[model samples]
Target: MHLARGAVFSLLLATGLALPGSEGSKHHANKARSAGYALKEPPLTTPWTDKVGTEPWPEYPRPLLQRSEWKNLNGVWKYQNASGLNAVQNPPFGQALAQDVLIPSCLESGLSGVQADWALYSWFSTSFEVSSSWKGEKVLLNFGAVDYEATVFVNGKKTGFHRGGYFRFALDVTEHLVFNKQNELLVFVHDPTDDGDYVIPIGKQTLRPSHIFYTPCSGIWQTVWLEAAPVNHITQLDIDGNMNGQVNITVHSSAKDAPAEAEVTVHKDGKVLATHNGPTNKPFQFTVPSPKLWSPNSPNLYNVTVKLDKDEVESYTGFRTISRGKVDGIERPLLNGEFIFMFGTLDQGYWPDGLYTPPTREAMVYDLQVLKKLGFNMVRKHIKVEPELFYQACDELGLLVIQDMPSLRPSQSKHVENCKSVPILPDEKQQAEFTRQLDVLVNQFKSFPSIATWVIYNEGWGQITDYYPEFGLTDRVRQLDPTRLVDSTTGWHDHGAGDFSDNHHYANPQCGTPFYSADSSPFDPSRIGFQGEFGGIGNNVSIEHLWKNQAAIDSINRTYEIDTTIEAWNYRSHILLGELEEQIRLFSCSGGVWTQTTDVEGEVNGLVTYDRRLARTDEKQWQADIKALYDAAAARSNATTATL
Candidate 1:
């Protein structure tokens, strides 16, 4: 593994609450003293080990809006770190001394082959020869995601720069292609982590790795690829369904004022439910009486086919309504004409080995499937944006999501006050970076059907003292996709502007009496009560898997006992689970999402381990308990309706 020259020193300077000195220093010291030195190299175990490819991440990245013709450009790439300003220069290519790292995986990840210590800025270059199939077709270069900021070049020609790291960006490179000759693709990435104020929700990332925080991940961390498309191809599609069961469809194209027509057909059980035709700009509405609503239990979906002349694209849509209305004289979230409680986990979607990238497409799908199996109907995706395929799997497998806008640089005043508990950007420049990234995140995933809620801020991380300005972030999301609900704040320090009164309570799941009072009160949970984050149960199954470098069996047992009994419970893993079930039973909870889905780095409070091989809690027992709570809530709602 190649360690970045200055990373260890920089990490030493940036260590916050963790032990003095850099993690690398601690790791090296521990390695020297240990007697069980089986080999010279560190253990090569990551979430992506079994799935690494010479040409990595070969799956079709975009499944929601797909095309039949494309090429996969994910594999080893020539890499070097350069100053962000000087990255435009053409670096020496194909040199062995220069680093060779795997594509779609970050430098910090084990699967990258070159496990360099994380760097702030880097350049990646790769070459491919165009096929002689068709010379006139448009070639598009696509990036699933790149952290913080990235710039793309084709054969030394500057193409474009994208600011956000969590969203997809593409450039049409057909005009710049030199057919039948070797062409080069160069990418420059700049990720400040917490050093600068950027809207990257460096959620668990800190210079210090302890408790819930983790090691920083920077640079090009997602898939990079190239595809061929028709000159006048479909760029994007927006599908909106009304409460009246009428669906509005709009197709966007690069070709202007072309005589483009859209033929939309909805099918269920191999039978055509409805069909309609209209111009590209116009809305195509189709109605079905007593519509089959989409829910976690049934997840009824209608297949939608859109044909424009010779080009035909197929996708799916769900008929469901999410709104706020009065229930028992209090405003609460209504899902599909009924008050359904949402129980879920805060899914940061990070892996120990892969960092941001999953080992394989199946690995990504497995997380969502396991959540479903554990009886969770919803997932608050934390403060990170996932690939479209992750959301697509949620749609297909029947899961709800509360997508968060990645955190921005926190204000200095708020930063100082919350420094002990939260992660904040160290400077104002970082805040600007955070805003640009947030805009990109909102635009990219706004169209997904499974995403029912948008979270603007998590706790006080990256939050300003007066968070109303941050509500502008919520306003932007509302304008982009008004169909879904928005939570201005996920946890404490509420702005009281968005749809839910989100709260984070650990150990105890009780919503304060003042929060539920109908009388004049500041924090009223009855109005819009949602347990945004709670539960952090840590159950360490094996001593060998512990992150600590110390190898003594006795020390492992002592540490595990202290970490699990008091610290994990104090973090409220057991208490929150019990209280969460009770709150749903009492009919006071609208919906709730726990602190996390899996163990991340030093945070051992996840429901499952980082590798996702084991569950912390008894799965069958939890599922039965959750189902009982859900059933009780449903019965209460039914009885209230009967009285009406």
Candidate 2:
């Protein structure tokens, strides 16, 4: 009874160019899809869904390390579903798939144009001709992300396979590619969403989704594109900077054995500020004289370009520092050595239509803009890694980020049920796989200045509690990236490690003390505590905006203690923030994060509605209340500084 499809079209534009086999090439299709594609109606959808067009997320997928020449491969493509690994041992090859699916979207989402029944595996096939300009160059087939496992085939030749669901992967398809010809690109994805057989980090996804767990995001839920690069190209740029204005840049080149000089240039407003040349894969530093520091009040970023031989890539970084220091006799996280409280939201990145993916680039930007406009300064990206574009938006919008590593647990979470603490020691294979993914995550996301802290575990979801000063989880993360602050454990079962003694309370806010000092010391200023999560004020602002699934209904029914009216929700939220202000002044609380930014399916306690159409509170009053927390925090910080 609650659905709207104002400009939303129907679902499939199945008609397209054929590939290489079966009475011609049914695999290859025209990149320019006609405006005749159909759209399916979800329970509630964002306005940006209408603007997605046939080419969803046409913007460049990777903004941090961008190249000029690239093609977005996100549109209608041949598709089919399978259940077993043996069924997909041999790819469809030259054969045309019976059904059509919108590329870069999982089959379960309405945006995919084929929200078919649940399947363990899927097959996608498409064909494209490489630009003649890129004929002699190495063609890198890039996938923004594919959930679980993905095996790619080009021109019927098995090309490459990637295991992770959240991190990005690229394969040099130059060998499998037939130059100047229409090459058929096929992919097979297998996602065991919380299957008891697999222990991969599923975050909040569950096959049997309910109140807390969300609908599963399987297959390619992000952008798929192709970028031309040289054989000896710059693969990654590890960038870091500090308060002393010294910027470190490390270039990772494809041709590691071959000697090549990495030429790095730092610029602002099209003018060069600093430049350095060093050997590839080795870190080198340069001081930016009179550096324009980056902060939430003024987010300033300097662009940089790294060139190695015939390959060059563009990147950007913000100069800021995160350190632990005491304010008003309570330890706090200092932003650029000043205690700036992070009035944040617990942002679980989910969409009704796209699931794991946002509708458009502008849509993602709007989420960050919402925080910026409302006087909130941070977002704890809860247990899910977003595309680099999300981080780029945070960097540009001046919103600090506390990024959580995805957790591994299938059934009802003990942490969510408020059960007693019990460390989950995963199997050896699970440990190795999780560690591998964490390594990639730390290496991948370290470039952004907006990420103030790396939260390893949330609510002890898939954590081994006693992982301090020993082996496995916590120590490995610190070993990989020590530049940023690390929260070894978030909600409960705190292992006395990492930077923060984080706690979670429902509808009320409270702070905790630091755990384990560097030298077994009593009081260490290098540690602090914060409210990881609090305040789930549920108010369904509009019936038309609610997700009408059974799980959603059950979730609403179970909210026996929540206030559902707009006025009551606002009143409760305001009072909670006021209490948190006092906590910041008296307790060892650095800041507090509201339970959520927007409502997910079923769990309807959000500042904004699920479709992002309505705010439960009056915008002006909510902004004023949030701003007051920072003012109180500043006064406490100022008093502490005077004593120092």
Candidate 3:
């Protein structure tokens, strides 16, 4: 299969194709040579940057609810940043697009190959022919996510419109389908991204990114695909792990009338363990004799199959229960009626090349793999909702997650200011939208067993008032999902609601730190104690891959110079571990979460780099340290529970 360099070039050119190295070889070579020695600036790429070729992010975006027949609408598509006159109401489908950009990845990301700033309007046009095999089935166009607002068109007809950037949405394009004929799929996007007057949740995105905030990501940032399903099909599946060797399942069907009777089967290793027949759009409980409990040590997940008429869907769920119980007079998170210390890092899930989107499926899996390998049991997905795949990965890998609702119009000054109280309030419109978004978020992610906690607000970022007369946000979350615990607000400006008393500390945490540590017994009796965030030990990797902002870089380089090398970073990790052990021993604290899992743009306070290049501590040493911490904590729990 191999050929000579010249022969390969000749053959490719003869076959009306350009060789891999011939298209932009010279430019790449020049860039590589100029990266370090000759050039003043470093290369804006990671080791996996070049891996994003042709069809990037080709994995099935939704693993929880999977379908066999689907088309991956990822890869290069005609794109144009609609500015000035180009920002039209309708898409220019017939005309040649100004440029080509990769789908799924946002326009601002390097993987898209169109690193453009956030545009007020943008258009994406692509043509697809309906598969002859999917003739009778209903065609559904699914979008993993589209930032702020998106208007989708099919064959010159407006199909649907969607708002919000973090959750999945779908459109039924069966009506607009033309059999065998090529159909034009067009999408128009508009995102204000924290700059607009409307208060929309932007997570950590900022117009002028500095310190903790990152560059704004706009447009389609997740996968776009088409799936075929029977008219009467399973729309949603919600599973709640019960204590009595059973799981409560609710199946939402698409049919309006009493849906056909559905059959549910639970299996492990192709061996059927349990079965039940229930009507669609109803809740059913199934029990497994001697059910295997799912935990960090043994993540036993059972495959589930649902069949209704011609529709069949496959899913998986873990049998586990999460609740609060007292351990040594301190309220702690209990899994399966046993006290388990929550040990995790703050997973922001950002990337160097792919801003909100991951470069590839493997890249996304790799981050979770690293976390699992490091022997951590949980991850607080800080402030941003990730694609379902991230939660699925956590489910499969047995990592508990505390999901944070992305904040809107976060005031950094208010967050950091020393104030006992302030009349923080959101406009009527903004408040309504925020409440709606939170409901959407809860409904979107309520199925996953790995999500042990729902973090309603963080650091008083978007939390306006202590109470909402018409059922508060945290109360709403509890009502939506009573299965999991809720951290109403993580740091300051606690609404005095939710299950956990959460707090945050920075730099170096020691004993006698108020709210950060207990130092004395008999802490707040109302809620479980948890240090939601602490230990931001920053360590720089290669300056070549640093963020473009020199001022931000300089600021980070100056402030966090203490942990310059891996050795120093390991020392810091040990120091943090010692502090955690102290918190577990003397404080009788329920849980603790490290500052972050990876370095973000313009912020070096992460266990690993943004590109996932370097780790602050050696894998073996870190895992061993974490394992010891867990064992010690578990032993303490056993001793405390024995007396009870």
| Per-candidate alpha-carbon RMSD to the true structure | 9.4, 7.5, 9.3
Runs off by more than 4 Å, candidate 2: 1-30, 34-37, 410-425, 465-472, 513-526, 640-644
In lDDT terms, which candidate is top?
Answer: 2
Higher-TM-score candidate among 1 and 2?
A: 2
Counting clashing residue pairs in each candidate, in order, gives 10, 11, 0
Give one digit per residue, the lDDT tens place, for model 1 in 450-474. Answer: 8888887777667765435567767
Which number leads on TM-score?
A: 2
lDDT of 1: 0.65
TM-score of 2: 0.90
Worst 10 residues of 1 by lDDT: 22-31
- Model 2 lDDT per residue over 1-644, tens place: 22232322122111121211111111222556744346677767986777766766666778779888787777888778875876568778898887777777767788877765555788888888886789878999999899989999998788899999998999999988876778999999888877645778889988887877888888888888888998889898889877778897789999888878988888999899888889997888888887788898899998988888888888998999887776666777888889878778999998888888887777777777777778889999999999899999899889999999898873343342456754444666887788888889999999899998888777767765444421345677777776777887777666567887677777677654333323222322446767888898675434567776854655664542467456677788888888887766665667778888888888778777788776665678778888888887788777753221
Per-residue error for 436 in candidate 1, Å, reads: 4.8
TM-score of each: 0.83, 0.90, 0.88
Pairs of residues clashing in candidate 1: 146-165, 196-430, 197-430, 197-431, 198-430, 198-434, 199-433, 199-434, 507-572, 515-525
